[model samples]
Target: MKNGIEIMNVEQTFNGKKVLNGINVKIEKGEIFGLLGPSGAGKTTLIKILTGQLKQTEGKAEILGKDARKLTGEDYKKIGIMMDNFGLYERLSCFDNLKLFAKIYEITDDEISGILKEVGLLEAKKALAMNLSKGMRNRLQLARVLMLKPNILFLDEPTSGLDPATVDAIHGLIENERQKGTTIFLTTHNMAEAEKLCDNVALLNEGKIVEYGNPKELCRKYNHQKKIKLHLYDGQNIELEHDKSVAKILNRYFEQGLVETIHSTEPDLELVFMELTGRKLDK
Candidate 1:
């Protein structure tokens, strides 16, 4: 199967500092691939190189089978990109903003309206971009990308400060786009976001990939132990180690009426991130 995005020993440097060093990654077509890292970890630099906004200092990247640096205007029509720094025109109405971008991408009016509705912004079509809430602006940014119906999308920190419900809505939009055969490349520090949306993720730190794999696989690989939390009726919370011997003990505790509500705790993406990066993800 052909890959949607391929980076071959890509490297980048700025002011004599290596931001990316011999990076290699392959994003399969139709899969949501994530780049997980914190600020100043070269995540934005990598995205810029992948989207042809900046040239790699060494090696190469190919998007949709064409050298990323060699992409032309026609090639851009097949790609969409959203980043935190790229803001919309605050003075323009949402409808006009989408229409203008669609014109730039040579997308039809019908496609623009459809994308607006798809992102749940149809009712706010005529609302000025500045008048919309932060979450709404974020959704509009996504809608702008969808208007082109690009085969590949590069999203950087797609959900940053939004509430959980809005974040979930954005995730759903990404899923919807993926179902339509769009290949999504997501970059975010939010481990939960990556775990919820990406099929596979690469952990980047100091401008290099430290780990790469399925979220579940990485979590299981890094976490050799499991734990279970017991919430007692008397407001006492006790944690039990999960092992063969502990399993029997837990069963006996329940059988003897000593246990309360029990819940198993597995290693999540945040744990995996810490294991790989040697620092907590929330930090």
Candidate 2:
């Protein structure tokens, strides 16, 4: 609440239909919080409400101790948002596109160059936005936002439709921001991304949060099977409950050099989401 984001019983309606329902969450300072759900799950709508783009139909939302609905221009300056590539100027070079925002934020040329390098876009700084690849365009957009050096960053599906390598690069950049103490609010259906990047996540479904907690802890909490799966050198596999009864068998296999690998049957975020919502996180 002091230096982070808080939403209390927030709800939203479009026309006569409700989109968000009784959503509540608290994100700590310098934490990466993920709002995860499939398409049409109101992830974007919740972001809009928090960012002051759209007011919630009911309840309160606050960022950095100020009411979201009353956030001023100065308050906005402390926030960076990269929701889409629509902010890019197709005719302008990447450098020029960033320069436009630089002027508005009073950022120096050296800082702009530094950000370009940081986002791995320095070499393509002079390339037109329209001519850049999708990945490069995404980086440029991220650069524009990072130039502000905002305390809070809102990234909605930052790596959607990107290749694995590019997604990794983007993830690295997000981690870099996290190291600098930026509070990141990310909305993605990618459960792997959430597990990799978030300190905590809220699983949203049908405009409501069905689950919320640390990603790894949530997975462990729902590990109903609690089995230890083992693969043997002889191409045989075995699963045993994580109980004292199986401890002797596990040790015997190890002593006999038959175990090749072992893993706990911990459910991942996708599986947990499915179990709770009866729907896949991707769909």
Best by lDDT: 2
| lDDT, each prediction | 0.87, 0.94
RMSD of 2: 0.9
Report how far residue 28 has shifted in candidate 2, in Å.
0.7
* Candidate 1, 1-283: lDDT as tens digits: 2549999999999999999998999999999999988888899999999899999999989998999999898888888999988989999998899988777667787787788888889899999999998889999999988777789999988888898888988999999988998999999899888888889999888888999999878877776667888877677888888777887877777887866698777688877777677877545
For all predicted structures, in order, the TM-scores are 0.91, 0.98
Runs in model 2 deviating more than 4 A are none
Range of the 10 consecutive residues with the lowest summed lDDT in candidate 2: 79-88
The true-versus-predicted C-alpha distance at residue 122 of model 2, in Å, is 0.8
> On residues 1-283, what C-alpha lDDT tens digit does candidate 2 reach at each position?
6789999999999997888999989999999999999999999999899999988999999998999999899998999989963568999999999999899999999999999999999999899998998899889989988999999999989999999999999999999999999999999999999999999999999999999999999999999999999999999999999987988999899999999999999999999999999999999
Clash count, one per candidate:
0, 0
Output candidate 1 Cα RMSD.
2.1
